[model samples]
Target chain A: MRNRQQGRVIVGFLAAPVILYTVFVASPYVQAFYIALTDWRGLSAEVEVIGLANFAELSGDPVFWKALLNNLVLLVTLPVVTIGVALFLAFMLNAAGGPRSGEIRGVRGAGFYRVVYFFPYILSIAIIGVLWTNIYNPINGLLNGALRAVGLGGIQPSWLGDEKLAFWAVLAVLVWNGVGFYVVLFTAGIKAIPASMLEAAVLDGASRSQIFFRITIPLIWENIRTATVYLGIAALDAFAVVQIMTGGGPNDSTQVGSFYLYQNAFSYGRFGYASAMGVVLFVVTLALSAFTLRATRKERIEF
Target chain B: MTTATHDRVSPQAAAVGPRRSRSARAGSSGPTIVVAQAFLVLWAVVSTVPLLWAVISSFKSDPEIVADPWSLPKALRWENFARAWDAASIGTYFGNTVLVVGGGVALTLLLSAMAAYVFARFDFRLKGALYYFFVAGMTFPVFMALVPLFFVVQNLGLGNSLPGLVLVYTAYSLPFSMFFLVAFFRTLPGEIAEAATLDGCGEVAIFFKIMLPMARPGLISVGIFNFIGQWNQYLIPLVLVSDDSKFVLSQGLANLAVEQGYAGDRSGLFAGLTIAMVPILVVYALLQGRIQAGMTAGALK
Candidate 1:
């Protein structure tokens, strides 16, 4: 009797979530692959299986190529810069304090700094996009206003309007928005390192930079690798930021794969063409994730 | 919230320095520490000034914002917020978001909890496969599903409606919520559940009366995480809902920015952005420790 009751409970518990997941998420993902082979306009019930024609078109599409290239650039730069700065800041906040009576300490107000730095990470991407778009405004913007106040106004450029600078400007916001979470993440990783190990290094007359390089970094390698993968995935989907801020404007300099896919399906109503791009992006994301995992694989230093 | 912060902080404090180890004490000059302090202070300012500037500019007149970006508003003009609320319909957008995200987060927690409890405690065939099925969704790019998902929603006649938005949000959120909560439920001691089972409790009754309450901390963490995620969501709402009156906060704010930025209602745009930021700001201020833990907890595990 209890066995039968447990079975009923399990089925009842799993039924709604399972059905909802299948219809809304699982099925749609499966269908994207099939839809990619079709010439579906998304306005009609009719869809024709064109057998890789959309992929054929995608190969020659300059905008899609440009967008993919930008994603690649982000894949490299966003992780490197954001991780570099976050590593430095995390070290400073958690371990860079001057030794007090041979004890390594985080700088004063480390907790306070952590909270303030994490502000951007909590806000919606839309708000971040809007906030930075206004801040990057060519005229009457905070950045330029600060520059002019310091008497460097002559070098002011139209940040979003200039195709050369637009992509980099957006990338800067991405880094800014991401660095705080990693600082906290890396701080936790650093905190996990045994204090005795660090104290031994200090007693042996190791410099701050020396201890950081030789000891702190090796132990936190897992955190850094995890960060690289997450940031790489984030770099792939620079959709919301690009869509809200530039709308793939300034000569399409900042077009990203996800945003381009969005435009193709929503703006142009070419569902088939967009699905092709989606499949390519999905493959690249999987490959990058696997590559990051394998490339960053190292000996686990058990503590 | 208090417990989560204390749990994370105390261990680090004990690890960083123990006065009992007097022999290990070392000292360095003050200049290095000062420099590090200055650097961190600079970054904190960099992180906050744009937000502060936006809040400050929201009160300025349109000409004042254009003319003097840095100066204090000559007078507190609350009218900008009013105009955004009434004319631009930020008020309506705000309500729609409250309804959708509230419903979405509640549903996500309940459904994920029920499923997660079973996954955690049950012994059954195909359990691993079913759990992995949910976990696999974590890595699949939501972009790939957009084309079919749009049509799927339209076919269900949930197109352009707030309830449809809630369901989609809940669907996408299930993977992470289940992953987190299943691990969470496992961490819970099984003795109390066993005792309840022996006390003539039905499995469903044990879940509602005992297991769910025991899982409160985990539920709260996952709940806040989903709340913030669904509240800030952009793409899902943008694709799923097209009706203007049904727009969520993110979509509404983006539209307001484009429309008002071009319409030269600069102060109004600033006001709208600030208005949109309020709930998040308040939540963060109150439960920042929980928020940080909720977000990073998944990545750590």
Candidate 2:
């Protein structure tokens, strides 16, 4: 009788979610695989199973390759710069407050600083895109304006207007927008390290750098690793910011992969070709995630 | 490493600890600490300056902004905002966004909580498979499934409709909600529900009365996270809602910026950007700690 009641509850509770999920969420994921293999323009009644033809077209497509190459560059530089800067800032914030006391007090106004630093991360990326575009404006941008003000007028170039500088300009914004989250993340990780561990290292006459590399980083490896993966995933998709800021322009200097996928599917209605890019992206994302998880797997350090 | 040595080391730690360091610290930390603090101050400014710049720039005339970008606005051009709201129809866009995001967040919280409750407490056939199915959604980026989702929405007769967008948002939000909430429910003691069960309370009553209130924090965290994600949602509304009038705030702002961006109306453009960002900033500021705690709560766990 008890087992029967359990069964009834399970059936009643699970039915709606299962049906809603299967139909709406799970179905698309499944159908994408089929769609990628078909010549469906998203509005078509007939979808021919074109097999590997879309993949063939992707290999020859220069715009697709350029976009993928840009993604690769972001995947490398964004994580390194963001994580490196975050770790250093987190350490400074962790160490900045009070006297040389061994306690883990933060800088003067740490909580206030935390709240302020994390300010940009909470706002929409679209707003950020718009805001940065103004800051990078050729005629009236704050950056070039400041340069001219400082009597370094000759050094100022159109920051986002130049093909040489556009990619780096966009990258700077990505890093600026992302670093606050990591500062918060790494601060938490550093705080979790037992105060005793730091005391032990300090007592053992470890230099600041030694204490950081030998003790602090080894302990915070898990957070760093997780952050790397999350940042990696974020780097893979630069859709809205790029679309809003540069529109992959100045001769396609900043076109990332996911936006290209959107352009092909929607702007051009080449759904099949776009789906093929989507499949490749899925595989790349999955592989990168899996690799990071595997590579970062270390013996758990007990505090 | 032995217990005896560990006990003996405590005195050394105390003797050579912060007390000894304080004498040596003042002489040593002069330059390095100063440099570190300066870097932090610089970073703080880097993060903050643009938003403030945008807000203040919204009030300046186009010519003034171009003439001396650093100077304070000559006068507060309130009409920049009025023009943005009126001419660009940001008011209509704001209403549409509130309706869609508000509805989507509510439905996602409800459906996901129910499903997560079952997954945590009950055992049934295909239970493992089903739970994993929901968990898998968190890893899959929405862009991967966009084309099919677009097709699916149209086929379901949800084309260009807020309800349709809400349905998609709720469905996509499930994985994160299920992942976060199932763990929450598992952490909850089962004895409360069992005791309630002994009192002959119905299952529905047990969930709504006993468990729901208990899981309030989990619900809030997951709910707000869903709210933020839905509010900033751009890609889904872009493809699914073809009617410009039905666009969410993200799409609306992007459209507004693009339209006014070319006409060189700097004040109006900045004003539109400010309008789009202000509400999010306000909500985030008021609930900053809660949102941070909720968002990073998953990571910390």
Candidate 3:
């Protein structure tokens, strides 16, 4: 009797979340997969099932390929640049230490710098997009203004206008907005490293460069891997920047899979096609995350 | 390991070249560090310049903003904030956002915490399978679900409603919130709960009186994260809500910005943008320490 009652309680406890998850998350996912194999245009009740036809269509879609390639480009570019710069900044801040660290003549304003760097992160992407739209404005914008100031007036370029430059410009905004979080993460990771380890190395007369590459980097490998996976997933999931800034324009040059999916579902009402794209994106993200986990998994060093 | 080699050679180099290259080394090394600092500072300035410009422009006349986009306002136009708030019906949106975020967060915390506790404390069959099932939800990009989700909501007659938005947000945030809480609840001492059980305390009793209080920090952290995510949510609400009265702050701001273009009499829009950013900034500042600690907790472990 007691065992049965205990079992009942456990079942009751698990029921709510499980049901919610099943209904909202799992059910929708299953429905998405089903819709991917159909000809539903999101409005009419009438629909036709076409097994793998949407996938076949996607195979030939040039915009699909472009968006996929843009996502791939973002995946490659963002992680290295954002994480590298963040790690460097974290190391510099860590090396500087506390009050005395900021009191040093050149580093006197480190606290102010940290806040300024992190400020962009708090703003919504809509704001960031709008802000950058003006900054990249061909007429009376900062980029053009600076070019003129530097005597490169003739080289003033339309940043978001040209197809080749649009993607890179968008990528820059992402990196700028994202770097602060990684900086905070890396800084905390660096702080968690024992001071004794560094002291011992210094006592042994180790050069600064030797200590960093051999000791510090190895210790923070987990953070580096985490940051990489995060940025990779972020690149895959990016939408707001592309949506607001270019609306995946310049002839779909800036289109990413998410933005493309949005356009298909909302603008074109091609729900079935968008659902197929969503499935592809899901598979790609899952594969990338698994690959990252596998690559980063090794002997865990207990410090 | 390489420090031994460095030590062995350092004395010889110092003895042989004490004064020969001191000035040159200083000149070269000093400039390098200076250049690096300069670059970092420049990056920081560029990142913040737009926000500063926005805040200042919120106070300026339309002509002034057009004249010098980067310059400070000649006079503060505080009425822009009030005007924008009234014009955009931000009051209604604000109320709806609060309802959705508050209800969603509360439901998420209750459901996820209870579920996490069971997973953490009980050794049930299919536990690993269930845990992995929840984790899989995290792996799926939400954009994929947008179409079907809209259908589901509409089918259930929840379209264009605040409750529908809350329900969707709860579903979306559940995976991570549960994941965090599970990791957290597992860290609690099992013996305490066993003792309560031995004393004939029911599972609900112990959960309410003991585990819930103990899990306060984790719950707070998860709640804060959910609040931020749901508060700033744009995509879900944008799709789920067609009625202006149901819009969240983010969607409202986006609509206003798009309607008025980036440069159009944007003093009011800037004020709206600043107003939208203020609540989040204040909350983040107030809970910055706890939020940062919570974020790093899992990694450090």
lDDT of 2 by residue, B84-137 (tens): 888888888889989998998888888878888988998778988887888777
Error of 3 at A101 (Å): 13
For all candidates in order, the CA lDDT equals: 0.90, 0.83, 0.78
Report the C-alpha lDDT of model 1 over A90-170, residue by residue, as the tens digit. 999988764344568788789989999998888899999999998988789888888899999897889888999999999
Show where candidate 2 strays beyond 4 Å.
A1-5, B1-26
Q: How does each model score on TM-score?
A: 0.95, 0.94, 0.89
Q: Which runs in model 3 stand beyond 4 Å of their true positions? A: A96-116, A140-156, A295-299, B1-36, B296-301
lDDT of 1 by residue, B189-301 (tens): 99998998899999999999999999999999999999999999998999998999999989999988888877999898888988998779888889988988899898888
* Residues A1-303 of candidate 2: C-alpha lDDT, one tens digit per residue: 767777787788777777777877788888878888888775745779999999888889898888989998999999999999999988888854433444545666677777878877887787788788889887788888888889987887787778999999999989988898888889889998888888766656566677678887899999999889888998999788899899897789999888898998899887877778888999999999999899889998988
Global CA lDDT of candidate 1, please? 0.90
Looking at model 3 chain A, which ten-residue stretch has the lowest summed lDDT?
A: A97-106
lDDT of prediction 2: 0.83
Q: Could you tell me which 10 consecutive residues in candidate 1 chain B have the lowest summed lDDT? A: B20-29
Q: After aligning candidate 1 to the native by TM-score, how far in Å is the CA of B175 from where it should be? A: 1.0
Sort order, DockQ high to low: 1, 2, 3
Candidate 1's displacement at residue A82, Å, is: 0.7
Q: Evaluated with TM-score, which candidate comes out highest?
A: 1
Clashes of 3: 0
